[model samples]
Target: MTIFQVTLKNCAFYAHHGVFEQEKALGQRFFVDVVMDVEAGDALGSDDIEQTVHYGLVYELVEKIMTGSRRNLIETLANDVALGLTAWSPMIRRVEVAIRKPSAPIAGILDYVEVRVEHRN
Candidate 1:
């Protein structure tokens, strides 16, 4: 047996997803990365997209979730992305989602804060 993996890295979105009212009202930038273990089936040999997970629609689903809802934690965002990806396509056997928040409201100086989550089907 062989394994096929697909990755979409560092997709950026602006949204309100934090623990403060200011964070909710003001919003911040989030970078999302998704990796999936894909059961490509005939897609690997036949070059047909229909036999695998559609990453374009995957991005759309991520966009919809990020933009449509207000959440208090990036952990929720990560979990949602992982769950959504696995649910969106039966061809996706497993998924990992990472969310990076560059403007996290912490008193320390760092590159960013990230939350990662994984889901398996």
Candidate 2:
């Protein structure tokens, strides 16, 4: 079994996702990274995209989730992305979803708050 990899990094979105009301109202920038291990099957050599997960579909899935609704936690966002990846394609064996909140409502100076979730078959 060959493990094929697909990664989407720095997928950015502006959305309302946070615990505080102001944070929800104002919205913020979020960066999402999705990595997957997939069974390439024939697509590895056949050059047929149908045998593997189409990354465009994956990006659309993430976009729908990131821009469509409001969530209070990046944890939930990460988990949802992981689950969605698996559900989107049976070829996916494992997935890791990372979400970075640049404008996290923290008092102190920091880079960002990130939440990551991993899921497997």
Candidate 3:
């Protein structure tokens, strides 16, 4: 038995998710990266879409989660994404979700604030 991985990276979404009142009101861009590990099984040989997890569906799920609600912490958001992806596909043995806040309200000059979360069956 072999394991395969599917990754969706740098998925950008603009939403209001933050602890600060100003952040909630102003909104900002968020980037999400997801990696899903699945048992290759027949999918590897068959080359069939049905045999493996659909990447588009995963993207849609991420988009829904990112735009759906507001959370104070990126950690919570990443956790939600991990859980959501795991639940979305039974074939997914493990899921890694990373959330990046580029315009986070910070005093010093920085690239971004990021949080990574993982979920496994």
Against the true structure, whose lDDT is highest?
3
List the lowest-lDDT window of 10 residues for candidate 3.
Answer: 81-90
Any runs in candidate 2 off by more than 4 Å, and if so which? Answer: none
lDDT of each: 0.89, 0.91, 0.92
What CA RMSD would candidate 3 show?
A: 0.8
If ranked by lDDT, best first, what sequence of candidates would result? Answer: 3, 2, 1
Error of 1 at 115 (Å): 0.6
Error of 3 at 14 (Å): 0.6
State the lDDT at 35 in candidate 1. Answer: 90
**Superposed model 3: Cα runs more than 4 Å off:** none
Candidate 1 residue lDDT tens string, 1-121: 4569989999999998899999999998999998999886888898887777888999999999988788898998889878878878888888999999999888999999988999999
How do the residues 38-110 of candidate 2 rate in per-residue lDDT, one tens digit apiece?
A: 9979998989878889999999999998988789989998888888888888899999999999888889999
Q: For model 2, name the residue pairs that clash.
A: none
User: CA lDDT of 15 in candidate 2?
Assistant: 92
- Residue pairs with backbone atoms closer than 3 Å in model 3 (clashes): none
Give Cα distance to truth, residue 120, candidate 1, Å: 0.7
| Per-prediction TM-score | 0.96, 0.97, 0.97
Root-mean-square deviation of each candidate, in angstroms? Answer: 0.9, 0.8, 0.8
